[model samples]
Target: MKQSLILTILVTLTSFQRASAIPFQVRADLDSCLNSAGLTSIYPSSSGYASAAQAYNLRFQYSPAALVYPTSENAVAAAVKCAGSLNVPVSARSGGHSYAAYGLGGQDGALVVDLSKLKAITINSDQTATIQTGNRLGDVALTLYNNGGRAMPHGTSPEVGVGGHLGCGGFGLDSRMWGLFLDQALSARVVLSNGTIVAASPSENSDLFWAIRGAAPSFGIVTEYKFKTYPAPSSNIIFSYSYWSTPQATASSIFSAFQTFAQTSAPPTLGIQAILASAGAPGQLYVSLTGVFYGTKSDFNNAINPLLTKIPKPQGTSVVTYGWLDSLVQLGGQSLNTSTTPDGTDTFFAKSLMVPQEAPMTSAAIQSFFNYLGNQGTSSDTVSLTTLYSMHCEP
Candidate 1:
């Protein structure tokens, strides 16, 4: 009786799998539909398909039934309509930086709407700019800077796409002062799931505007974003301090002091990050604090001196002043004149948690973290725990 029951279960599972699979004929039908919609950049599971599915994270590798590159909003609408008509799942790919590689659909046999071809940036007369969703942060920064010394707060990674980044509430060096990337956004143009194009703002499609601000991927395909830009600061003061320590208590002490400083003393124009890593001698650890201040050197020194006194002694320290664009290069770990493509891709898994502002970092918690790191076999693979000072800013 047991053997018969197991056989029945296996047969049922196999049947369900087969039912869900996308057959060759179905894929061909979808491809034909996409091609018929006037999309010339369509790629099926042959010739250029592999490169079309590449993502910033190597771990997310999925081959969609069809990948369509739509150059204009009309083209995007056509692709969406055709995908819906054919009953094929669809995903939008901008900078292809989805952590789980969701830009290509977490599973197989979906249609990917590749938006990399739409790269237009128009600066309005009123200090506002209309940016296409396909523009990467690096390209956006350089373009804005070169055009009029304008800037916007965004993620540190230069390769992050404006669509998914702003859609998910982007934060970066200037975030503490200017707020998130979404906060600067005045409006957006989105293609809804029903294949209709709509403008969303505070006064138009207000509900959709609100929903798309933070929950964008679920709502629609963002075609473009209009943002209010600010005059770029003339220069930035970058500083770094590092300490070597094997004891968990030392790490805890440094973290506790840094947290207190970040909460109480740090100004909005100052951005600081703390990194604890097992990159020292075998079985040892180190702590590093790095930051950038978007103000005069004198003002930066005055504001950071008190915090420096509270932290433990650093084994080394460095400080430098740089122009606005150059400072971004330093922060992004890219050469001054390098292209905007992402530096590299890697295979990794990540987990995250949000700690409340009022909560304290106790020594016990720090020791537990250290213990966990110590047990993760020594294969020269590095592990890092990073903390950034983030506070709510008025929009």
Candidate 2:
């Protein structure tokens, strides 16, 4: 074990809502449609509506017209049909973890198709998994580990729904080795806007398959996803190096070093990111370089040494290794193993940028970024910058 990060920042909770509410008659009509189709519907006047309509970000909280909990594909299709008939817009909520709360329609008065009740995973003999998209990354990880020594590239956040995560190009520690979660998707069962369920694959509904893999919510709702799986790695390790109260110059150097080393020297087995966070003192920020290596502890130090040699010495460091299930838990938290609750809510404002391997950040731009942060980065407490390269290496 080694030293870890030191700078700490506390967040203040804030709630935001528009002056919008659904009409009683419309909510009642949507509920009636869902109830007639054997689905559970919660209206604004109904109990548990507030909790059911809550967004993970808490900032984009909006009152939906109706919440539909569909237990089957037919129920999901029925809800779609009912929405079409009533001339209502519909949004599907998988984990309700959208930063912009698009799952809640990104606005009010949309019929929300809640899919928490539809999580079911099937591991086939050919190392393929047919899982309901309603399952979160945590649910998928635990099930794959328990049923078979299997794994797939997914998000580090366990609370993110597979439906939304994969669609938005899911990234994880396994991503460096296995590509994205969408890359493993073999097929999907999608309910179209007109209430028809169809199978999307390369050989069938080829256009629909392509659209669903990336921009799924734009087209329709996916009920289940058939994914290609891999044998879980026997040796999984996580490492982190923290620098406390780093000056803007050193922070800029570290960023430049990481970008250069990762594009050239970092192997596919390593997935890494950096964070420049508030240190509470003026002109002070802490930076941490952390990620998971899909190889053994014996080779981890060697793989990381080049990057460390390029950057300033870290004040604290830590390295740990675990098995398949434990590694997932370590990457996230205990929620990766047994997460039933909604986890935690936050009021956040975040922006992300992906730097491709073809074009690394220029030295001048890197310095400018740090300079701006030191001078005027107080709007947010922490800024996590993740740079992913497509090494295209085999596992």
Instruction: Give the per-residue lDDT of model 1 (tens digit) for 33-86.
Output: 777787865455367776776755665567677788899998998888887887
Best by TM-score: 2
- C-alpha lDDT (0 to 100) for residue 177 of candidate 2: 83
Write down the lDDT of every candidate, Cα atoms only. 0.74, 0.79
Question: Model 2, range 29-139, lDDT digits (tens) per residue?
Answer: 777878888888888878898888888787787878888888999999999999998888899988777877888888888999998889999999998999997888888
Weakest 10 consecutive residues of candidate 2 by summed lDDT: 1-10
Off by over 4 Å in 2: 1-14, 21-25, 378-380, 390-395
TM-score of candidate 1 against the unseen true structure: 0.89
RMSD over all Cα atoms, model 2: 4.9
Off by over 4 Å in 1: 1-21, 280-283, 335-343, 374-382, 389-395
Please estimate how well model 1 matches the true structure, expressed as its whole-model Cα lDDT.
0.74
**Prediction-by-prediction clash tally:** 0, 0
